[model samples]
Target: MITTTMSASERFELSSYRIPGSDSCFYIPEFITEGEEAYLIRKVAPGFRPALGPSIYERLQIRDSPVQRWKQLANRRLQLWGGELTSNNVLVAQPMPSFVETYPDIINRLQQTGVFHGSPHGKPNHIIMSLVPSTDPSQTRADDSPGTKFVPCLLCVVDIFLTVEVCVCVRVRSMSQAKTVPPRSSSTPSMSNRQLQPHEDGPAYHPAVATISLNSHCVFHYYRYTLPESHGGRSIDPTPVLSLLLEPRSVVISTDSLYSNRLHSYVPPFQARLGMPDQRARRIHEIKEDRFTAGGAADFVSPIANWERVTDAATREVLANGGALTRGTRYSLTCRDVGKVAQLKSFVKR
Candidate 1:
């Protein structure tokens, strides 16, 4: 079954464009053709359904091709695929289902991205595609209370919690039902908007996150570290060091500094704009110019610091290109590895 799901032709073609100075991380623009993009959107539609209750809508969220639409949440909006992280930070073992894996070119190119080179599986074992609704007052609640209501919640109509274990690898068709409530915060609401904090991705899974931007274009914010002290009650600082212009159909792999050293989040702006020309801007929605980046060294791409410890030169070559690295409504396939499978089952059963 796994072999059948793995397509021979579906791999990243431009294997040369990788990020410089970084150990891991890769970027590929137009990783998927316009037609494939439409096909994926159509395939995910059926899986989108209410999870908890009727209040929330569960369905694949995407606008017409070239226009990215981000689904909103209190903190931010993101789609979850594969399976939820176990309480201990491990993902249950399972193959990335056919609907996702059928695109071999995209996956194969990513294999060379170097993000997954160190994992036990030697490639991304799971994938997730989701749309983050633009952040706004509607996304927030009345009292300004912080919790899942503030974050956003997906209603899981299905009570399917793979109790039997089986290294069950299932994709979250839509995050409409997943809990988006915010954890205890530290600092006062400093920024006009809230976002994902900059912190090392915990050992919950592997150390890489491969994101594909779709719909509109937006900048993903990254911070150096958590706040020195928890101000509002939360301890992390989700700020923007630099922003990645996530274009529709582009693929961005988050590993090394992009993944381990810093925190990443989407910045929701009232008016999104793209610095590039109208022809290029039209490829995505809410194109923004200078939303995050400044001038000089900032103009060129810089690899995440501390990433050298993780990957080799061959893998880094695939990330530097200018393909499908759009911003708005981006979906990420965070490939990771949990530990020994048989032992994991024993632990989960307990």
Candidate 2:
């Protein structure tokens, strides 16, 4: 039986964009149009409003509805759709947001790609939304001082945990800030909002993973997977096996051994510039790329496996200049065919 809403031409074969020498990792640039990308951003961000009088409504809704709308974390904030799991790791069963399934219709298109062909339900029933903030709130920028103008780039994730059977991401943002300003600096040398930690989805779920970048461009790293500490696996080597440039509106899917055997992370604002002789950035995100770089000389483009695939001249030039691009807030939608789910009634009886 056929289960996809999109036609064949609209669906892409995953193998065509496979990374060289990799088993099942694929990258498709500009998977969604700019207009479509804008639409998705408006839905996830707190500042968006279709009407003027209700400006405060969305901010309040997000702030107040922590259990349903957004969950605050020590490192970041995220939303959960479908349902949260029980202590046993079984999902409670909730429907995904209508906007995610319709309008842009992300779920249906993903189904068409055959990315979830053999899962329990043959489609994702749960979605994990993640937000990784790129900037520290204490840092003051020229545009962010009292009464200054600051417009943030809504879809950039510098330290994002993007994983799932089918992962779709937007941007991770903390405070709203403009893209035009340089990295916010209070100290002569800046530290990252957080360290970049390389990891997988872990025991929470099992399956292939896919991601779509909604806004901004940055380098994503994949490393040889290390067994967990509990398993006495070797401690993670911060050096990357491969680095790929993730552009806005692009899609990357990892299946089979690639999803399970590799650890992935995005470059941070500071780490990308840490060792440059003239650069002042001291620390950014987690992990290291010291294997291929010498004193972190600006070779961002050369280290990435898909650097040549980048189409924009300005972006290409910036990567070559040893300067990291603006990693605005980024959001992600990770879909998985949860193993077990129970209705509210079923749970009540338990």
Candidate 3:
């Protein structure tokens, strides 16, 4: 057997910061300064989107959402950046825009942290961001669902093996679209559940998954089990292995065994509760009143479910002082690289 020999740090890049209660998870708070965050939003907002056409822009304004047009997939809606990537997963071989390379210095620092050190391109060439609102149905938008199954599509190009459409970037929205807390009995879609799926970044791209959460906080749960019998894998209990508290402005990266060895998913209806153990609570409601209103919605609440803790001492230190994990809305940005462009082209043409 060819034993994979490498330092523990080499496997997960966990040395960049204190381990977050798990050997695989790393959390960095304030990864981007407020100013830089504002700048990024300004640059990517609808006003500055790459030109699809005046008609598309007009339609976008009328629709009141960035995803006015595009094919919606089972997981989440998609808007291809840097021109449509080839089906084989390689970009058109064009340089990413200057703005992409110009993301805040912290992003550059992320590169130095060695998170993407082993990727084919040594850096992410594509970006996928999602804006999901709270409140079901009313939460309906154009985003596609990734569905519940993992279908492996493989093709070989030259000497390179490729897998198509593995999720590279999966960002969850982070703010309360409601802006104010409604009656607890009131219903609203609050969490972007797909953002929390336990699926792997897959074999097509770098194993590392860089996720950033904005606006609110939510619990991300992970499970471990043998690949299903039909897939001919072993048997193991799919028990809760870990759960992460994704806070606004926080950055989390996971890879190596965490990427390939487990399944993860987020419990929906995210909220901010206080006065309870995060590991033993569930957030079954959304914050509908002003997030700061007294006695209304605290920044943190007891999530109603039993979550396996994955936070570190440092992360807990920072979270303890916040205004409860306020139940504002949220958005997640997952950056990844998927391989399989050459084969994708053939399918596209046919």
Candidate 4:
């Protein structure tokens, strides 16, 4: 198990993980132990079997008994440990699967770090386990659901055989770059760029999201949205403002403007270009290598956001040398505390 001796004061001193040039984003390497990561993979992998059936009963029979419930999507498979949210965006009151609720390393550490101290439930009550195939074109999109209000998300990524790359984009909100709206009441001040409107469906967007990576490393790119006279609307800036090298077992947290305004997506494996002038040729050349090695010359083609704070010397060396990472199947578990919860009927009798 992963152990830490840091006191509360030390744990809350998260300034080291903060990514510069953005409002409030943080990254930590190796948030979980190797053993814990392996166990999580085992627990979620069985649901990926092709034994899915058209009927619910038929699907349940694939495994005599399963701990979690599965929902297959067009390009990926999802296992929702807690009950699904209601039409009004409330999570039905239900216990999470034991495997999910009992993970003390991740749960406790997050609490100690004070990431979810202000959330409605004071902890994550919903877990969405996503199994993304290597060839899937659609990546996880930005979530603005009512369930995401006032909660910090903890996303854990586990890859099988080191073959997948996950990318995250953070949008930064600024006063000069944003359009403002007058407040409805005198007591309320004018809203700045990207601030949630009163009529907006969901609660205001939370600023923090924490992601832990396991089994493999990938690149994270950040972009700013731009409006052009030619297009008559806003579009993603072709070139990323910054890029970061996410080493295996690392964790990244984005807050404030980075979480509310930025758009994040994972770049497809073996794609030739990433639209940045300095990275275009480097990315193409790196993907061309027949066997993807975690460390090689192609990895350091761009400036990593928090290079000085990395604890692992080898990871630092790999990035300095520009290493390469191969693609593989990856599983991401995103935990959130839905703002609304209703005592609805239970799906499982337990």
lDDT tens readout by residue for model 2, 225-301 = 45577867666655566667777777677777767777776654444532222233332334354432322423333
lDDT for predicted candidate 1 compared with the true structure: 0.43
Which residue runs does candidate 3 get wrong by more than 4 Å? 1-18, 47-76, 82-97, 105-107, 135-197, 226-239, 268-329, 339-350
Ordered list by TM-score, greatest first: 2, 4, 3, 1
lDDT of each: 0.43, 0.57, 0.45, 0.47
Worst 10 residues of 2 by lDDT: 163-172
| Residue-wise C-alpha lDDT for candidate 4, range 208-260, written one tens digit per residue | 55665544454666656767658587556534466665555566776566666
Model 2: lDDT equals 0.57
Q: Tally clashes: model 3.
A: 61
Write one digit per residue (lDDT tens) for candidate 1, span 1-350. 00112123554333343544334545555555666665664544434322221123323333222222334554444444444456665665444445565553455556765557777777665555554533344432222345443222234333222221121112342246544445546555423244343445676556777776544444554556544664554343322344444445666666655677766655443323323211122322232432232211122232232222212233223233322222223344444554433333665688
lDDT of 3: 0.45
Candidate 1, residue 126: how far the Cα is off, in Å: 2.6
Task: Give lDDT tens digits, candidate 3, residues 75-151.
Answer: 33434433445445455433333544555533354565577887776756555554434323332222222221222
Count of backbone collisions within predicted model 4: 16
Q: Which is better, 2 or 3, measured by TM-score?
A: 2
TM-scores for every predicted model: 0.52, 0.67, 0.54, 0.58
